[model samples]
Target: MRRQTARLYLAALSKYCGSRLGKLLGVGCGNGEFLAEASLKGFDVSGLDVSADAVQTTNTLLGREVARCSTIERAGLPDHHFDVCVCGYVIEHTREPLEFLSEVHHVLKPDGVLLLVTAASGSRPVTLENALLRTGFRSVEMMTSASRVLVLARARVRRPRPLVSVIVPVHNEHRTVARLLETLTAKELTGADKEIIVVESNSNDGSRVDVLRFAGTPGVQIVLQDRPLGKGSAVRQGLRHARGDIILIQDADLEYEIDDYDSVIEPVRTFQCAVVLGSRHSGNGKIRVFADQWLLGLVFNSGHVILTGLFNLLYRQALKDPWTMYKVFRSDCLHNLKFECNRFNFDVELLAKLIRKGHTPLEVPVNYRSRSFKEGKKIRVISDPWTWVWACLKYRVVSPYGGDCTRRTENEMGDVPDTP
Candidate 1:
């Protein structure tokens, strides 16, 4: 319980403090550090500060397209526009911390959060100040890290608390799994809202040993695969055992860069979106993404976007690329879905199922680094536009969520292995 609680509180601080409903007036928006971050994450932001210099700095930093002056908070900037009001290091220096907190509440959409991170006073603060913050808001909680506080009181944040499940699909990654287990063992996710579920598949590589080591960690559980299967299969099995309101899908390969659990859960913690796909196509991705394959790789990527785009649109779903990158989804969303292809093709099928069910998904661009062929590029000659397209079309016609899908009697397609 404590493990899950720790995660929930931490997620609340990192991602849930949007101007409540993403409608808000930010005071002391200096240089717009939080504002720019929010906007990049898809929030609608309007900001203000006592210093014009600060406002100029923000515009200078983020470019005019994304930065705007907030001296006009008087314009009311769309009333009830924020889900969480941001108070950076402002409270400690301000004469009226409480009134400023009140302003945060005012511009905040009712039920929005107030996120305050300031230097602790006099006697070196313990995590307990978060408790005192609830006095001014609705509820105050400290996340996994001791430096931040999530305050929600005046109005209730829609998801008073979110349940999150971290799913790691493991194969022969024993060395990496040890690090992952170490990380999961320390996560502060709790209160029936969090769990770290690792699904192990055929690992001639001893990866299962790493996962088994966490057999006793609170909220840490593992399910073993009966046979060697693809990464997607392990993900499906992990999801079946997941016990959280939100679910995350991550590769155990250790190539995807993620530093904090909060950064991992931020996408689904605050919004009603059905799924969030991590993109390597956004932001400073160039710094991390190297065009590893010099051949038809570029064409392969372009074709992937085109084919998946068509499949998604044909199913009425809008997405950039369904077959690549890490993905996160609501547990309920997957409950209504089905995976037609078990191997690489299943990635395409997931998007199809989502679209067929009328879900509009979102994206988050995170750091991505491609690996070398020596690092196991399981995708081979057959896993290209041909296979992706063939499987994509095959599922659209016969998969459970697709338009023409008629549940086949068990005797039909069961003979085919679920590899995608």
Candidate 2:
């Protein structure tokens, strides 16, 4: 029965890695059945078993020194030495599954494969699959056999798809909310996997109802904020619930084009910078708002230039439009920033804190169309400039260890309830 089981597992492993001869490491070579089968199938095999007697028996049976008595966590094996590592029915026995799997990960070559077999009766299967994903394994497959399940995961040495969280802050703009949501969900932006989290504040203008229309859509989450917190607050709320590898700020207003999302995220994907900002005034003719087009536009555009210049001077980073609504950053960057601004000053605080952490944001040219205040624009010309100036200076001196400024609620912020 043991030899038959070994042949069945070898068949499955052969399906993925092909019948090619390579090095294989078995975590628990009980009585040497599996490694013996691998050896017959043209693999140079080594193994680790907890029992010294079992190791000696396996070595004697194989007629070579193939099995070692060692724990997976402290296997003392050289790195990048094995092409495949097999842990059959051994993960549940390990006290530290993650650490043990990480050790396996460290030992495998760049394109190495890890095959895990566990009983299907308990929570072990689910827990093991989650552990594989969290440990930087690229592709994970779950297959079932008689009374057992197999998890085949491949090691990713370098690049992997970055999961993006698109935080859309919605207010009273009933006219464009639905269209915005459609654009976000209809097309795949950046060619990278992403999820949309819409944080809706108290909008009496039916914008909340419009967003609820897409509640049934996959990857679309509608978060309802009880009060009229500012856009910054809504974004902060979304950040707490985001599970993506990258955090991208999306505006609900129609001023920023959704088509620019690819360009905004490209910098991070190419590894040029950890943070990226979409600039409207980057000499792109596609930029819909020009200084000569509208007087109010010119004033705000000039203010943006001045503020961006001040950020460059103080932060020693050259960013053309620091206040641009389209900002894409790595999720880990948030660890250095204790976000407090529940309003427009959130962008200012983000720029200041990121600069203080010594990260320079790469600016990418993207299309933008400025909306007039009469067309549901929210920023106040008189007060916003002062807020931005104060936030930029204040965040530079404040330590991130001071704790996050926003409060969290027990509500399922990412839950999309039954669509009403």
Candidate 1 regions with alpha-carbon error over 4 angstroms: 1-160, 187-193, 260-264, 283-293, 296-300, 316-318, 399-420
How far is 319's C-alpha from truth in model 2 (Å)?
1.5
**TM-scores, all models, native as reference:** 0.52, 0.60
Model 2 lDDT, full chain set: 0.76
lDDT of 1 by residue, 1-420 (tens): 122332332344454443224444455676666566656555676666766777787667567634444433243555456675655556666565445554555566755666554543431222223222322343333221233323334443334566677788787776577886676556574332567888888688777777787887887888888886776787777777876667777677666764534554665554435577776665321322336655545555556567757776666665554665477765655543556456666677776666544456676656656654556555675555576788667666664544333212223222322110
- List the global CA lDDT of all models: 0.57, 0.76
Candidate 2 worst ten-residue window by lDDT:
405-414
What value does the lDDT take at residue 144 in candidate 2? 53
Error of 1 at 332 (Å): 1.3
Best by TM-score: 2
